[model samples]
Target: AKQIDDLTLAIIICLSRLFLHISADSKYYQSFFWIAMSLLQIHDTKLFASCVHFLDQIVHSMSDNGCFRGQGLATFCASARKGPSERMLAKLDQLSGLSFKYDFSFAVAGHLLKGLKNVGTKAAVTRLLNTFVEYSQENNPANVTGYFAAILPHCGDNLSESCRQRLLSCSETGSSVFNAGMVPDKIRASLLFTYLVTILKSSESEHEQLYIYKALEEGAHFMPDCLPVTFDVLMKKMEQILVASQNDQMLTAVLAIMNCVYTYGLESSSPVATLNKQYMESIGFASLGSADQFNQNQKGALIQAVCRVLDGFLQL
Candidate 1:
C-alpha cells in the first residue's frame, strides 16, 4: 500500500509540473492530459486536488487562448466526452468540495457539449449519452452530477424514455448529496429549475411529469428569477400539446406543473404570470378550431383543464 501511495504521489507531482510547463496548444498536452486523467484512478487526497486544479486549468486555457476553437478544443472535448475510467469515477465520488466538484464536473460537461456540436452522427451522440447513464448506474450517481445538470438543459431533446428516467433518478440522488452540504441557495434553486426544464422538454408520459411536479413541490423555494424560464418552458410545452399530439394526460400534467410553479413562484399580478395566463387561454381557444377532430367529452376535458390553470392564476 505504501508503495502504491508513493507511486500515486509521484505521478501527481509529475503531472502537476507537466501541466504548469506545457502550453495549451503543445503537441504533448493531449498525451499529458490523458495520463493525468488516468492517474485519477488512484486514491490520494493530493492527487485529487491536483486533478481538480488540472481541470480548472483546462478551462482557463480555453479562455486564455481562443486558438483552442479548432483542433485543441476538439481533442480535449472528445477526451472529456469519453469521460474518466471507472476507478477514477469511484475516486471522484469519495472526494468532497463544492467548488472543486463543480469545476471538475462542469469542465468535463462543457467539453463534452462543445464536442457534441461537431459530431456528424446521431449514433455517436447516443453512445456518448449512454456512457453517462452507465456511469451513474455503476457508480455513485453524484460522481458526475454536474455533467447531468449541464446535459439536461441542452441534450434532453434526444433522450429516450428509459434514459430520461435514469437521468432523473441520478439527479434526485445528486440533489440529496448536494443538499447535505452547504450548497448555496441560488445553486440549489438553479439545479432544481434545470431538472424541471429538462422534464418539461422531454417528458411524454403523465407518470414522468407527475414525478417532476412532485419534485418541484418538494423544492419549491426557488428564487423569483426562475419565473421567466419556468413560464417560457411551460408555455412551449403547452403550445406543443396544442399543435401536436394533444394527449389529455400530458395536458393535465402541464397544468399540474403550472400550478406548482405559480403557487410557489412569482407575484399574483406579475406581468409574466399574466402574459402566460393570456397565452394559455389563447392557445386553448385556438385548439377549438380543430374541434372536429375531438369528441364532445374530449373538448370538455380540454376546456376544463385550461380553465383550471387560468383560475389558479386568477386566485394568485
Candidate 2:
C-alpha cells in the first residue's frame, strides 16, 4: 500500500512539473494559473513541496522575461534580463483577467506568500503581489477584508523593507485594495486577529496600535460570529496585562475592545454573552481591580469604563 501510494505521488508530481514546463510560455499563462490552482489543493506534503518548486520556477521565468510589466510593478520587474516581448505582454494581460475568479486570486496569493520565504524570489513575489493588488482594485470584491487578510502575511517582518513599504502604500486608507469590515470567514478572521494581537503586543507606535484597535472593533461588532477565537485572543492579552506589568495603553485598548464587544453583542444571544458576563465578574475580582496595583484614580477609570459597557448591555 505504501509503495503504491508513493508511486502515485511520484507520478502526480512528475506530471505537474512537466505540465508547467510545457506551459511556461506567456501565452499559456491561464493554463499555467489553473495548474497552480490545482497544485495548491493537493494534500500530500511531499507532493505539495514539488508543486511549490515548479510554481516558483515558472514565476521566476515569467518575471525574468518581464511578463509582470506595469506602472506600479515596474520596479520589481526591472531586473528582467530582457524586457518582455510586446506579444508576451498582450497574451499575459489576457491571463491576468483570471484574477476575477476568487479562487484564482487567492491561489496566487497563497503561492506568493509561500514564495516570500525564499529571498531569491523577492522580485517575482513582488510582481505577483502587485498584479494581485491591481486586479483587486479594479474588481473590489465584496468580503474584500477576507482577501486582505489572505495576503496579510506580507505585513510581517520577513518582507523586504521596500516591498513592505509598497504593500503599506497599497493598503493605506482610500486605496482600492484596502477594505474595512468584518473579516468574512473564521480562518481569515483568525489570521486577521493573530496579526492584530502581534501588532498590539509588539508595536509601540500609537498610530499602529490605533489601527489594530479599529480592526478589533469591526471584528467585535460581529460578536460570536467571530466568537471564541477573536475574544479568546483579546482575553489572553488582557490577562497578560492583569497578571504581569501595567501598561495603561494596552489597558485602554483592552477596555475599548470590551466596549465594542458589549455594544455589539447585546442582541447576539450567543454563548459569548454568558462568557462575557462571567468575564466581567472575573475582572472585578482580578488583580486588575486591586487598589494596591492601580491607584484610586486609575482604578476608578477602569471601573467606570467597565460600568458603562455593562450598563449598555443591561439596557439591551
Candidate 3:
C-alpha cells in the first residue's frame, strides 16, 4: 500500500533550505546542491518546480534592488560543474537584461556565458562573444571589457583568434571603445598574454603554429608595455622546460618570443620597435668593443636570436 507522508514533505522542504544556504557561499557546494536539486525533481516534481520558482523570485528581487546581494545565487550560477537548463537560462537572461540597464556590472551575464561554456555550448559562446563586441563598442565601459576578458579564455581556438584580432585593432587605434584606464588595459593585456602562452605551451601542429604566430604578432603590435612581462613569464617557463631538455617546448617558447618582438618592431616608429633596439643596446650589442669581451659575446648571441625572430616578422 502506498502511504502518504507529511513528514517526508517537511524533510524535503528543510533540505532545500539547507542546500540553498550552502550554495550561496561556496561555488564548490553548488555542484552538490544541483545534484540534490535534480534528484528532488526526479522524486518529487512539485519540490523541483518549487525550487525553480524560488530561484526566479530571488533573481527578480535582486534585479529590482539593483543589488545581487545573495551569495548563494551568484555561487550557484557561477558553479562551473553545473548544467543550467532552458528555464535556468531564461532566468539568467532576464537577470542579465536587468543588470545591463541598471547595474552595469554585467556580473550575471558573465556567469551565464560561463555556464554556457561549461556546458560546452559552442553556439552560445559565439553568441556571447558577438554580443560582447557590440556592447563594448557601443558602451565603452569597464565592465564590458572585463566581461569579454573573462570569456576569452573559454572560447575555442578559432574564435579566440578572431576575438583577439578585434581587441588588437581596437587597442591600436587608441580609440578603444572600452575604458583606457590602467585596470581595463591591464585586464585586456593579461588575456592576450595568457592566450599566447597557452598556444606556445600546447601547439604541435603547423596549423596551430600559424594561428599562434598571428596572435603573437597582433599582441606585440598592440600592447608594447606587456612585452617585458610576457617575456619574463615565458622565459621562466622555458627555463623549466629546458631543465628536462624538452626541446619541443623550448623551441616553441623561443619562437613565440622572437615573433612577438619582430612584429612589435615592424612599425619603425612604434614604441615596441624602439624598445627592442634598446634591449639589444643594453646587452652591449649596439657597438663593437663597447663592453667586456665575454659580456659582448653573450649579448651578441642574444641579439642574434632576437634578430632571427625579427626576420620572421619582417616577412609578414
Using TM-score, give the best candidate's number. Answer: 2
* Residue 280 lDDT, candidate 2, scale 0-100: 29
TM-score of each: 0.36, 0.42, 0.31
What is the alpha-carbon lDDT for the whole of candidate 3?
Answer: 0.39
> Tens-digit lDDT track for model 2 on 1-316?
1112577557656755665556434334424433443433232334445555655555555555555545212223222212223233222222222121232333244334434434455455555454344333322232234334333434434444543444455454432232333334544444445434543554455554555655566556543344344353456656665576465765676677677666666334343434533532332211111111112333333333323333332332
Could you give candidate 1's per-residue lDDT for residues 136-233 as a string of tens digits? 23233444454554444334456556556665565545333233221244544444444354444555555545455444444444354544435545
User: How badly does each model clash, as a count of residue pairs?
Assistant: 0, 0, 2
Kindly give the stretch of ten consecutive residues in candidate 2 with the minimal lDDT sum.
285-294
What value does the lDDT take at residue 24 in candidate 3?
Answer: 40
Q: What's the lDDT of the predicted structure labeled candidate 2? A: 0.41
Q: By summed lDDT, which 10 consecutive residues of candidate 1 come out lowest?
A: 285-294
Candidate 2 residue spans exceeding 4 A from truth: 1-29, 60-158, 173-214, 218-252, 265-316
Q: Is candidate 1 or candidate 3 better by TM-score?
A: 1
Q: lDDT score, residue 164, model 2?
A: 46
